[model samples]
Target chain A: MTRSVFFVSDSTAMTSKGLGRSLLSQFNVTLSEHLRPYINTEERVDILLNDIHKTHIEDGDAPIVFASMMDEKLMNKLSQGFAGVIDIFRPFMPTLERLMDKKSSKEVGQAHKVGNQHLYQKRVAAIEYTLATDDGLKTTDYDQADIILLGVSRTGKTPTALYLALNFGLKVANYPFTSEDLPEFTLIKAHLENRHKLVGLIISPERLLSIRRERRALGSYADPKAIAAELAALNSLFARESIPFIDTTTRSVEEIAASIMAISPT
Target chain B: MTRSVFFVSDSTAMTSKGLGRSLLSQFNVTLSEHLRPYINTEERVDILLNDIHKTHIEDGDAPIVFASMMDEKLMNKLSQGFAGVIDIFRPFMPTLERLMDKKSSKEVGQAHKVGNQHLYQKRVAAIEYTLATDDGLKTTDYDQADIILLGVSRTGKTPTALYLALNFGLKVANYPFTSEDLPEFTLIKAHLENRHKLVGLIISPERLLSIRRERRALGSYADPKAIAAELAALNSLFARESIPFIDTTTRSVEEIAASIMAISPT
Candidate 1:
């Protein structure tokens, strides 16, 4: 039987899910996660308390809770009943409060709203910009881009760009390196003006061959020689243009985005 | 004059950043944040130690580090020199270890790679599917979609859809309800088969007006009366069709997505 796990939170940012994911990964347990978000009011808390009790009864095991409650009274109320609870945020709050020389607002969802609405807008706008500029579509607005990624087809330029935009609020425009810009070893003509922001993406020929073959197995698109030449040329161009590049061979999108942010500050 | 802060981790997942953002928000501090990712070795730890030391000297304050290093030896080594380090994951480890009756692998980054590469591929495919089906372009894949979003212009369908696809690896296809289908009270012609997966997104007319006005100042597109009628009709359609709906007026994309997942658990 799968253990029932509850991700309880006062704030509505899916905090418990993200916080619990890393912690829970350290364990080897088969769990069914229930998200109880916006757990602010006494009424909601009462419902959750009952839900947890029912879950305990039904599962025949005390349901584990990963909570990030901001309210002290509400947390106290829940703590009274739950035996297998881990207050995820409470462990860190005391040190933070002491360090800042201030008490937390204790108001639900206040921490995020302080200066984050602007950041929220930035992310939404970045998503739009990334989509509009995907695969080198809109170069005229390259001036407004935070970073530009250059790569050959299917080297994972689009997904990486969207990840940066969605998670980091960075406007990223990605261009697939074309064979036309070849021989001269230039990446792109007009949009290379954002050259300061340009970063190249590279993948192993073997990996690209397999990925391409997955879509269509008939063409030179999956040819080993063609893929190898394309990569070698791209590497030469990256070196000649003094552009920083990443090998997206084994890295996940999140890892790639993090590496890009570290490699290029913007 | 800003305090220096570092998000230290053996993870390449930006664990430190995500963990640090939620925790640091509880305090009142002006800080410059540094991401020290993929800190898997003693050599890397030595470099980080040196960087932290230099930062302390330059800032005239011991740089605060929010660490999630799984390796106990590396954590001990870093703790020996740093005064302002918070071991974010240490407190919960004992309880988890006891509960699971298993020792954590402590092999850096192994937790995520377990069955998550398939999840990563799911996300990439979801992103592609969401893009292809966005704004009702490709309806043949309705059978393959996890959820279908119905909304008018600029109600935050595409962003929410993309967020679900990227973060949760859920394939979401969204279609804008056209005024042509108004008299019949049907949402879309061909996609009605996926009505069980349909979720209508609503927004305040005033909010929609302001948003639309930002794009173009003139036309019925931004008209308040027009927007009001559209929303009223959509709500009626939601009631008549018995499809679930969400109000995106005040919610951030994260909040909206969280609410949608709660409202309609696809």
Candidate 2:
């Protein structure tokens, strides 16, 4: 039987959905989800309850509700009628209140609003910078970059760069290694100048081959022998230059970015 | 006095930081933060508590803690410590248990792990697709895009496209409008063919002018009059073609993406 899951929150409901999906993935069951964000008022709550009650009667099974509502009255209203109610915010507040020796503001939807324009502008600027400097497109401003990523194609550089820009407000530039730059072990003049900001990304030959194969089918570029040679050359280059690097074969972009942030000079 | 805030979690601590920052921004106090992720073990908890205690003594004030640990033992240990502790997870678990009449697995860090290889690969593929089709590049494969964003420069199209790709596993392509493509009000052949997928983004003249000025300090491109004309022309085109549009002057990328998803056909 397919289960109905409702992600209810006074704000974005992102955390509710994320945690709900994580928990639900453990069980082998099909679930239909409804994302109900900005459900702050009693009117909205009444509508949500009606929808849930209707689904319950129609399916003869209560729906699961994952909520992040800070309002205790709404949480009480939701808890009484659902098959399962996971209020992500309320349970943790009391502990926080006791620990802080103060009360929470019991506010809603503050996580995503534009409270700090400076921080917001920084994120936007970083995004623009990332787009401008992507894949070695422009290097005139490489000196201004917070971190520069160097890697063979499809080694997860672009996504990692964008993630750093979006999450940490870092100005990230990335360059991909090509066949022309191979064998000579010569860095471009711009790269040489900004070598201190460089971090190399390498992946297993097998994984590289598979990823390239998906992009372009059955070419020399996707051949395992070619990939192995390129990786070996790149590794030697990184070692010769004493540049730090990470293997992206198994790690997620978050993990790789975190490692880079840890090692790279702020 | 600058308050010290610790974001502690058994996972990435992303939610802890996000929610913590949101709440903290409401208060105008100066605060410093430490993000302590993957805090799963008793030994780690001891270290964390000790650190908090030390900070309390040094600052002569308690450090606030925002936590998301699933382990009750860890929660108990943290609650006894200095300042306030916000356990983001536990308060809701009991309510969920009562409603569902089931016990939680009490697992940690499941939200971000590569639990499903298929979903993970889809996200990566979407990212690759977004990069390939960025800035009106490679329209030969426009049919493959799930959403096509059309806008003038600095209308927040590229970042919105990337956010959709990263967050929703959507293959997004963005095209920027130029003066050459304007006046005639003619849709590009590729855009015309895939009109159903197109979502227009427009920004206020003042905001667009400021954003463009940041890119090129004082050029014809950054002229306020030129930007205003471009926005008026684009809005007219959007109106003439009956394409839905969003004004991104005040909206964040998350909000824009959500609105697009709400209107766009999945």
Candidate 3:
């Protein structure tokens, strides 16, 4: 008899993304999808009760319910019927209550002001850099990239670009460094030439070996010696082309993005 | 004369990009190159003191040192030196201190385990989806994207795509739906027939009028009827192709992304 768990909340809570999915993975139970966004208090309560009734009559397992930012009236009502439910918001209530109590304090107001100001300033700064260009760089377009990433295979480039774009708000463009374009330097054509920065990424031979090995399980591409040769060739080309490259062997995407953001000329 | 404000702290402080930048904008103070990860006590003191000295001696204004998450030892040392500085961490101190005092509580350990399990489950679910794809979907290469974006036109596609990518971790390739792209998309074949999704966002006529007026003060593109017609044509084509589309007139990127993610059939 598998115990079923029901997550009834707004749309954000129901999606297999964000906090809802995170919380659901904890318990060994099935999740009911009856809860959805923009649900009125009455509908939510009905869904909760229905779920409880279904679980009690059919499964005979008292299902656990996790709700986010739920209405107080509805929660109180559900608590009466579903005694097995867990309200996650209860944990954060202390923090929220403390914040509310401190709302009267001058220091709390000042800190909030400072925090809001920081948010605005960052957006403005991001906007300013996003408008620059390369070459004559007269217009705000592709020519203004601080660093353009080009790579082949499973070189973690996109997440790195996004990290640059979101964290630093840098204008980053990436093109695939395919085998046909073996020597990647000369391909830096038109707007990309000498205007924007370029960074090449090289993965370690052994690391590439294992990644490919896991892919096809003992395929020719997974051969360590072949992977090593490919990496060495890529490295040679990078050195010859005078492109600053980093080996993303053991670093998390955050670490790699941070390093790139650090070296990037601001 | 501009007042200099030094924001010194570790990753959490430096990484508070949006919040920090907004605060600095309100003060009319320029942030010096002191922000970095892993700053120690002496470094903090040196930065604060130097900035204070520079503001007093050179700029003839008091320096506002907005420090976040400074070590307690360093905070004490600096507070003694610069009486005028504001310690943002002070607001969070009481709560943090309380938590520290309760470090021995069984509740803390249980809460941590629950949170970790929640995160592990979410990542596991995301990875499960990632592993099933073959077009280098599981791999983190940003360049092989189906659609590359380029537009200064405030087409609002980048933020929209970023919303989809970051939130859903979808391989959403977004090229700016610009005047340039008006010709480009016409020429290139839609590679993502069933494999990927393409979304074109058109802003409302009124919004386009106001946005264009702000930038150029006047333009044919800014004409309400002209803008309306263009959007109508784009909307018609999108509808005809059965391509999913969004009117980013009244929605945040988050909202647009949510809609896209909902319809993405992922």
Judging by TM-score against the true structure, name the best candidate: 1
In terms of lDDT, the best-performing candidate is 1
| Cα TM-score per model | 0.87, 0.82, 0.50
lDDT of 2 at B162: 85
Q: iRMSD (Å) of candidate 3?
A: 10.6
* DockQ of all candidate complexes: 0.47, 0.32, 0.09
Query: Residue by residue across B1-266, what tens digits does model 2's lDDT show?
Result: 47789988776677677667656644444677777776888898899999888888888878888887877788788877544787666555565565555676777655555344455578788988998998889998899999999998888787888888877789999998886665545588898899999999988888777777777877668987777778888989999999999878877676677778766886
Predicted chain A of model 1: TM-score relative to the true chain A? Answer: 0.83
How good is the docking of model 2, by CAPRI class? acceptable
Pairs of colliding residues, candidate 2: A91-B91, A96-B85, A99-B83, A99-B84, A100-B84
Model 3 agreement with the true structure over B1-266: per-residue lDDT tens digits = 24455554443233233233333433333444344433455764676576577666775555555554335677677767775445543443343234223222211012113234233333323323322222223223333443322222455554544534443445455443334334223313533333244556677777766666755666655667656556666666566666666666655444455555545545
Which sections of candidate 1 miss by over 4 Å? A1-5, A28-36, A39-64, A72-82, A178-185, B1-5, B27-33, B40-64, B72-82, B178-185
Q: Candidate 1 lDDT (Cα, whole model)?
A: 0.79
Candidate 2: TM of chain A?
0.86
Kindly provide the TM-score obtained by chain B of candidate 3 when compared with the true chain B. 0.50
Sort order, DockQ high to low: 1, 2, 3
lDDT per residue as tens, model 1, A142-172: 9999999999888889889998998778999
Error of 2 at B110 (Å): 2.3
